[model samples]
Target chain A: MPKPNRSFDKSLWVFHVNTGSCNGCDIEILAALTPRYDVERFGIKLVGSPRHADALLVTGPVSRDMVDKLKRFYEQVPDPKEVIVVGSCGISGGVFHESYDLAGPVDRIIPVDVYVPGCPPRPEAIIDGVVKAWMKLERLRGENR
Target chain B: MADEIIHFVEIIIGVFLVAVFGMIFGLLTKGIDRKLAAHMQWRVGPPVIQPFLDVKKLFCKENVVPRNAVAWLYNVAPIVCLTSVIAILLYIPMGSIPPILKGYGDVILILYLLTIPSLAMVAGGFASGSPFATVGAQREMVLMMSYEFPLATTIIALGWKISTLYPGEAAFSLTTFTKYPVWNIMGPFGIIGAIILLVVMILVTTGEITKVPFDIAEAETEIAEGVFVEYSGRNLGLFYLADAVKTVVMASLIVALFFPYNLSTYLGSSIHLPSIAWNAIDFLFYLLKLEIVIFFSMTFIRVSVARFKVDQVVKVYWGYLTLAALIALVLIALDILL
Candidate 1:
């Protein structure tokens, strides 16, 4: 096996996109920014635009209507990017699994580097997922570049 | 002439002490803002000593300037910002100063000096030649243009009111204006003018200091720390210090002009202390009042509202504020005639 890359371990820019879920997950995502969770100390930024982002932090189940928008957004992000499924809903549609409009577990539609498991994972866990995604990105970038 | 010379020396010393006071309050106000911002989000903030820790660490860090940066100006930007902010402190009437540089307190002079720090930062940003810094400098230029009109109007309205009330008199000096403060407007139109002036002053103060809702130049999410993006270590720290000092200076201006409450009278005007001691106490009173107003007014607005877009900010000043100021002028004129 080829050696793994780790350069993306330095800083990861996260872009958060809400699909279709209750605000519980969204609140926790912002909680990651609070003093206790303070992610800026690590150089991780919650970017407002996808173009500058290095990772996609998707929350909520992929809704049928949002499926195309999500794909378009993912396309806009530059290559050597990584995707993280941040909530159980994003992983397998969770409670919204039974909804008629449910499109997917995001991994089915996009290549996922890490799956952060929780109805809403603790911010530390989300940070871990991002770190793992960065590891995967570093590996890919090392091989390609 | 001898008395004037003695008074001038006293004013110089008074201004130096006030500058020191402004720096101290700048740091404390930042601590308070951080504590309050944390409380709003339901978390206890860092200890009040946190800002001190941050500065200490920044000082110890290795400094770096990008290879493309204009070496000389890049090194000079933060110093210019800091010096100009301190210079502004001299013109602001915090208390009874002995009158050194008293002649420099023309409202127009004070207004122009207020622009120097930001203008210096812009020059510094462009000199850095970084893409993000360039964008930040451009945004700052737009923001300054947007806010300056309303700010100018607020000053003019205050000057106009004093002129109308007293007639043909230039009561534009900080010491003179604060000495004879306008507490309330007597008539219906006067009240309207005063209220409008008060609101615009509050908004413009927030704008001039580049606080949130007006902080587009350093919008982290959009442009990645903006003009200061290229600055690191001590250079960055100086800009931060200048920013904190500007907050106090801007707040003091608001209080000196609008909320003119004097503390010496409360202690009994008959009881006199050393001139320095009296000035010190008055300075403290001015700071306390400024802190309360900034916390209750500007910081509250900063935390509660999301930032407006650049064009939106421009439209607000030109469309709403400019018209509001014009109305205030007409009302003040009416107060004079009838």
Candidate 2:
């Protein structure tokens, strides 16, 4: 495996995934991309396909139905990938905890490198989560080299 | 024998030079296009070197071929697309420099060569075996067939006009286009005809490059990147580069056909620069023209419109644009007879 170098850190094309969250976190994720927030200034783009993504921005708790599909999406992302859990639901199942439709938090299904804690995190918090994503990338670099 | 060997080596060198030029300028233009789009939307964009970073990062990532994919074809498709777009560049005159393969091909040959990249994408889409890719490929073929007619009419109408004026010359050649520009040697009616054809060509170019309104084939929201859904890492990177180069190719085609004037032609007599310096100046001017064409065709129009449906794309191209091209053709025909 090639070292996940500075270029990898600089250009992070993220795929946004919604397991079962309310539309709240999804809208915030979009807000981060709007002109006011403009995550693209930092080369953090929201792409449609996982194959073209370097990171996954996951919202919502892992529901029963989404567990298998979420796993497939995680696998589809090319390797040297990071997962950023964007809302409290994805990190701890939030309001959906122990519910019949739930499959637990995102961490159980895939390794999550960063977390933004909010019922539906602010766009600012999501941007911070992306910055925190680089710390995980740095740690990976240290482990590899 | 020695002279022939040397000539062959020069052609090889020129081909490499053209490829390098296309890749560098293509990426730069894409970055600029992105930045301009950001500003148009009132946002601060990524750095101009953003594309370079993306391509470098992509190369370092793992290449994933889906389980159902024809791995060989999936991999070969991007390579074919990139090389074919570069091959088309070899036939287009750059700045004051004539085409590398000047006599080997002409406008008619380039018209055929232009389809190759899209065709390669279609083949790759089918080979990927994804349902989305298949639908995208079908849309791409539909879009391809729709645009080719207006594109051909524009080229043929101009070529016919030139053939009449320059009797016995290679009217369909890019060299001929530069020398006997369609914008020149035309009366008021022909000029209007040429402008209409220019608009048609620009819109055709928009469809060809698959920007927003015409990007039904790669519609991100509708199809999850459609034909490229299965492609990852280096293969995606190649497609990215090919898209950038194709933008330059289409923009350059517009430049060569309609806006073929160089700055040095007017300034050289007064400035008294060396021949080499004049070539450099003309090259910069050509780049400016390319930027203008790309702005109007790719950036401005793309930012303004929402994506069209599959049928709307066909209707716009076949019903409206083809009609516009025919009107221009009739005007040019009238200019000749009058």
Candidate 3:
């Protein structure tokens, strides 16, 4: 992994991943990016390409079908990066925890730096999740020296 | 031989200076544009230095080369794009400073140079070997073709008007245009024509920079960032710098063609400032002019409207923009005959 720095904290381009999301957490992520919440003020832009991403905003319980795709997408994000798993589903599979089609929580598939535990976390909570990712990055920056 | 060597060294240093200036100013303008756009939307935008931070972060990230990509071409493309844009800047006179390589090239040369960066980008997209990039590169080529006519027409029309009036000088040179201001040699119809050309130039500039409404080739939501899909880290950083510098190139071209008159030209008599001081003043004024041009052509228009469809982009550039340019050309001809 490349060492983190101040610039990484200042501008975090995130790529959203929906591993069988129910559209609930994804909508909240969208809402957070809206003009009202405007995560852009913090320089948290949602990029289309995982290659350009500084963080992966993963949502939903990882299904059997998505497990491979999730790992591929995670590897695509360059170093000095973060993975913020949004919603309870991604952390513990939420209501889908007992479902037979599940591969399990997001962190079980790949490492997660932050988790926002809500059925569908609010925009404020999502923003907090991004902020927490920044702190983790800042700590890495400190450790780098 | 000694003086020639000295002059060569001086030109090299000046080129480096301009490249640095172009990069910094371009990023600064992009930051300001974002801030203005944010405010316009009734939201707080990122800090003015956000682009600088973004570029820095991009540089520090890991460079990812796709397994299927042609690595050599992918790496060279960004460098080619950045260098070509900087080359164009060397030929562009800014704020009473004649282009460093002035008499060697002309506006016609600039028109050609302007295409190289886009071409380099298309080349990179194709080299990346992604289906998305391939589609993006095709759209970019088509977009480039459609915009080229109006862009050429605007420059040629103005160049024709200038050449006809000033038969003795190096008529094709940007120095000639700056010396003999385009607006000054116009009657009512000619002024109208010049104004129309100015509008066309701005629209062409919008397309040239690949901002919204004309950014079909790189539509992020539609095609996963299009040409830049495979690019990341240092490669993406270089592209960002190229983009920022290209914005400066387009804005400066507009300023050169239409609004070349500087502060010191009129103020030289009354202000009694040192030549260096006056030069500084004129340069600042030129920067102000560039910002205003960029704000309208790139930022304001992009924020106010939605992105145009690929077909609409072709139609606007080829159909509407080209016709308007031709009408302006005819109007200028009428002015000349009268």
CAPRI verdict (incorrect, acceptable, medium, high) for model 2: high
lDDT of candidates 1 onward, in order: 0.76, 0.92, 0.93
RMSD of each: 9.2, 0.9, 1.0
Cα lDDT tens digits, model 2, B1-338, are 99999989999999999999999999999999999999999999998889999999988889988889998999999999999999999999888988888899999999999999999999999999899999889989999999999999999999989999889899899898898888787888899999999999999999999998999999999999999989988899999999999999999999999989987788877889889989998899899999999999999998999999999999999999999999999999998888
**Model 2: which residue pairs collide?**
none
Docking class of 3: high
Report residue B10 deviation for candidate 1 (angstroms).
5.2
> Distance from true position, residue A139, model 1, in Å?
31
Task: For residue A105, give model 3's deviation from the true position in Å.
Answer: 1.3
lDDT of 1 at A105: 79
* Candidate with maximal DockQ: 3
Candidate 3 lDDT at B33 equals: 95
| Model 3 / residue A122 / CA error / Å | 1.3
Question: In candidate 3 chain A, what residue range of length 10 has the lowest lDDT sum?
Answer: A1-10
Identify the runs in model 3 with alpha carbons over 4 angstroms from their true place. Answer: none
Q: Rank the candidates by DockQ, best first.
A: 3, 2, 1
Pairs clashing within candidate 1: B11-B100
TM of chain B vs. native, candidate 3: 0.99
Tens-digit lDDT track for model 2 on A1-145? 5578798777999999999889899999999999999999999998988999999989999889999999999988888998999889998889988888888999999988999999888999999998999988899899998
Clash pairs for candidate 3: none
